[model samples]
Target: MSHQRYEADLRRLFAGFPTGVSVVTAQAPDGTPWGMTCTSLCSVALDPPTLLVCLRAGSPTLGAVLDSGSLSVNLLHQHARSAAELFGSGAADRFDRVPWVPARHGGPHLVEAAHTIADCTVTTEQAVGDHTVVMARATQVTSLRRPIPLLYGMRRYGSWAEDMENGFLSYDFIS
Candidate 1:
């Protein structure tokens, strides 16, 4: 298979595995905010509360993150599709469209859109392919609401559903 075909196949395969959506945000030295919607976030370790996020190489958000040595991973809620789209659209005024406030550390926290915010300090970064894998230690976690995580998969959006019988939420892909 050609390289392009292989890449497409890999993306399709990963699309089958739905995951929560998040916005990785950082602030530049001049107080400018930068952010991008990201699904490539994962918990790396528990002992020190480590997490990782992959950001596109040369992205302004990535640059600001590196320069500031901090970031905030805002976990979007089910009602935050618009914010997700806005962040991903590369709009110059993306931050203006969303309601947010400065976090305790790192970048601003999406007030209405995110159910949780993890304020982290950058630990390490490695360039990989067209993206940079950023590792950070979460120094603070603020839970705004219960987890009705916004999910992305199969090129669609979904959310968790309450399973009353089990008294828990389950992956109920609406799309």
Candidate 2:
């Protein structure tokens, strides 16, 4: 298959698997903040509390993360769609438009948009295709609010709805 064909096919395949939204942030050596919206987050292990996130290769955010050896993973809430788009847009002034503070590990924490924040230290990284897979060890995890996750799949955004009768979470579509 051609690269384009397989790429589009893989995208369609993953679109059937919904995932939560997150923003990975890092502080450059010169104090510049860099971040991007990411959905390729996975838990690696619970013994050491490790997680992995995939970021576009050569992005400033990825560079900062590798340079500083530290990062903050902000798990965005349902109300944080604007932040998700802002960070995903590769806008130069993304930080200026959002309210954030330095996390305990020195990475930027989205104050208003995140339901949880995980401060981590870079453990390992590997290049794969057009992205870099970063494995980090969680040093701290702060739960700022109840989890009403922002979801992305099917080429759009969505959220979780409470099943009032069963008190369970269910998928709710949004434009």
- What is the TM-score (0 to 1) of candidate 1? 0.94
Can you write out model 2's per-residue Cα lDDT over 1-175, one digit (the tens) per residue? 9999999999899998999999999999999999999999999999899999999999999999999999999999999999999999999999999999987684899989999999999999999999999999999998999988999999899998998999898888888
Off by over 4 Å in 2: 1-3
Judged by whole-model lDDT over C-alpha atoms, candidate 2 comes out at 0.95
Q: What is the C-alpha RMSD of each candidate to the true structure, in Å?
A: 1.5, 1.2
Candidate 2, poorest ten consecutive residues by summed lDDT: 102-111
Backbone N/Cα/C clashes per model: 0, 0
Worst 10 residues of 1 by lDDT: 166-175
lDDT score for residue 133 of model 1 = 99
